[model samples]
Target chain A: MQESNARVGAPDWLEEIRWNADGLVPAIAQDAVTGDILMMAWMNAESLRLTAEEGQAVYWSRSRGKLWRKGETSGHQQVISEIRLDCDEDVILLKVEQKGGIACHTGRRSCFYRRLEGGQWASVDPVLRNPEAIYGKKQGGSNHE
Target chain B: MQESNARVGAPDWLEEIRWNADGLVPAIAQDAVTGDILMMAWMNAESLRLTAEEGQAVYWSRSRGKLWRKGETSGHQQVISEIRLDCDEDVILLKVEQKGGIACHTGRRSCFYRRLEGGQWASVDPVLRNPEAIYGKKQGGSNHE
Candidate 1:
């Protein structure tokens, strides 16, 4: 999806994105230094633009139906190092320095802490902090929403 | 999202997925051998169920509004080695053996071949085969839609 960078408005690169019918694209957050996939979230055009401009992670919450700035509540922000889009222009990948060394609301290093084994998913990673302590009680279910 | 596997109808784990308003979840396909993310696609409950049962990659095509069987045309099927659900239960990950060594319709090993550089996306991965050779003319845009 590369082209000359002289185009106006949203730039030709952003326009090349094949946004879903809902105007959303899947964005993956990977740890820049460790290359470990921290989490996967959705982003709309506005959130993507904001993320690029803000140099941090911003995602579209499908359930909440709004923009979600990473670390807005839990103090686990992701500092963007680089952003890359897949060849089809349908997926966005971010290389970020995960703050607090935790990416999952469950207090784990990554959202992908479980692995499939023998037709069952087993949690292989330990929770660095308790969710109750990280998000408090009222915000415990914030990540899922 | 794990639970005892005795529930009837859909499993309890599957029910835990907080599907979007459109009843979809973003699924990421990663190369089982290299750990390289090959592509990202959407999956509905049926597609996810089928992928788990069939042990292959199946995705929901938003443009076409139907289930897509990977490598149905290009012989680049992903033989799933493992399936994982993110902690939020909104994202899926598949570890697969990408057949034909090509995951992108553009004949690249992964769809994430472009790297953002200097405000521009530069293709850093070489195409192993030509798109014309992989899918012929009629199926050239099969991967996109």
Candidate 2:
């Protein structure tokens, strides 16, 4: 009784544990100061554990089938300030401190750069941080057409 | 009549503009398949057009005061397939085809790689791409501490 009571006053993030049929849950990341979303990813028990263990944001790569550590190389680390779970326990909202410019590797501050309009998509923002500057690529090699 | 009809049939993304005090809207990007949120950014009417016009994600960089294009240099491009707007018109959602392994400059598949537990942060994933390969000295100078 004493042991459980000692651990009782924890944050809501610690109690969140609703998993999908595939044993996964959706985790959403946002900028704590700006209220801007930085990115989203999945987490299982182990992946969730890894994120809490490290202050840097971490996620499960569904395609790569591995754990992904944020800022390991790029230096755009997310220092978490808070984590919240929705009522259903299936969704998580992370409030974090971003260390560098542009959360998206695509060179945009955010991943949502395309707009759906008139049955056509459009590019509204100019390309910042020349991809060559960020990725050292010839700017036409691997990105999808 | 032509302009009016053209506007009516246009995709919701274009027809509706979420004008804030500064004539901008908030855009949120989420994983198309996994429903994991990747990041958030801002756009004006013009910025939104650049994303659709280029077929790549773009955003207005408030910090840099420029229109930023995603993946123009980095291989990690987000090909937008669809865009959704909430009822408030102040927020937007982007559905994207992310390639080259990440949405984050930090090399995480998604920018968010941390989870909160018991009032402490946890690491939930591993590093996907080599940050040195993606960012070089720019991101390499940061400290893990």
Candidate 3:
């Protein structure tokens, strides 16, 4: 199956990713144009492959031990423009055009909404929408976290 | 000691970070001014504390099972300007001034220097210095991967 994927235009470079002991690599999603980091998630080999093939963000949910397509429940899918690997091949970066202008489970543009200020973490960014409105009552919690 | 730190104005928010089952959290280092993500590393409680106290990047070396002070070897220290936690508290973001203008041990401005292109991982950025020059004969390989 892996060989068939490579034959079907899947890049062999995926095999070069140096996954950690747990078979996971840290993947960061960044706004393609603004460079604002949207979020970070773990990606296993299968998730990375599917993400590349699907041109969307797919992450490995360690807590659930399953594949998770970003914004699957929130309708804020990330449209990947480019994928990058760190020099050490352990980290992945996705340049994405975020749909719905929301990326955080909190319904914020980015998960990184709080900033450290005066020895305190202050929520400096506004919540774009209440998460309850986005995910409904099933807004149990974030799988990526 | 922990109490003394709190008395000295250390915010208790650090304790709120939701580490993974492995007691590690993903931390992304971004160029404070440019907003370019320089690298990603893991941090444990101790490393996170030390980084906050020292105003530099400190990481937990999963492979070595020891704390690593960034730039301790390559003189490419990440002087942190601010540290932010994601809403979910599972990730950290550091706004840093990358010392020496190099963040990657491979002598690149950022560890994320390679981009996916034409079914291959292409090195799209220039190396500012050779790894040999940065770490001498001990350019032993990146601890990141």
Best by TM-score: 3
Candidate 3, position B43, lDDT: 86
* Overall local distance difference test of candidate 2: 0.60
Q: Tens-digit lDDT track for model 3 on B1-145?
A: 1223333543587777777767788899999999899999888877888888899999988777788999988888899898989978989999999999999888899989999987789999999998889899766867463
Error in Å for residue A117 of model 2:
5.8
Residue-level lDDT of model 1, residues A1-145, one tens digit each, is: 1112212367556777778777877899988887678899888877887788899999888778888999988899999998889977888999899999998999999898777665566898999998888888876454634
lDDT of 3 by residue, A42-105 (tens): 8888888888889999988877878889989888899999999998888999999999999998
Scoring each candidate complex against the real one, what DockQ results? 0.48, 0.09, 0.72
Q: How well is candidate 1 docked (DockQ)?
A: 0.48
lDDT of 1 at A142: 46
lDDT of 1 by residue, B74-140 (tens): 9999999878889877788888999999999889998888876766788989999998898887764
**Docking quality (DockQ) of candidate 2:** 0.09
lDDT of 2 by residue, B1-145 (tens): 1234334444555765646555566565666776666655667666666677776778766555566676655667777877755423446677788877677666777654665555644667667887778767566321110
lDDT per residue as tens, model 2, A1-145: 1223322653455445656555666666677787655555666656665666676677666555666676554566778777755433456677789777566666666544555557644655445566567656653421210
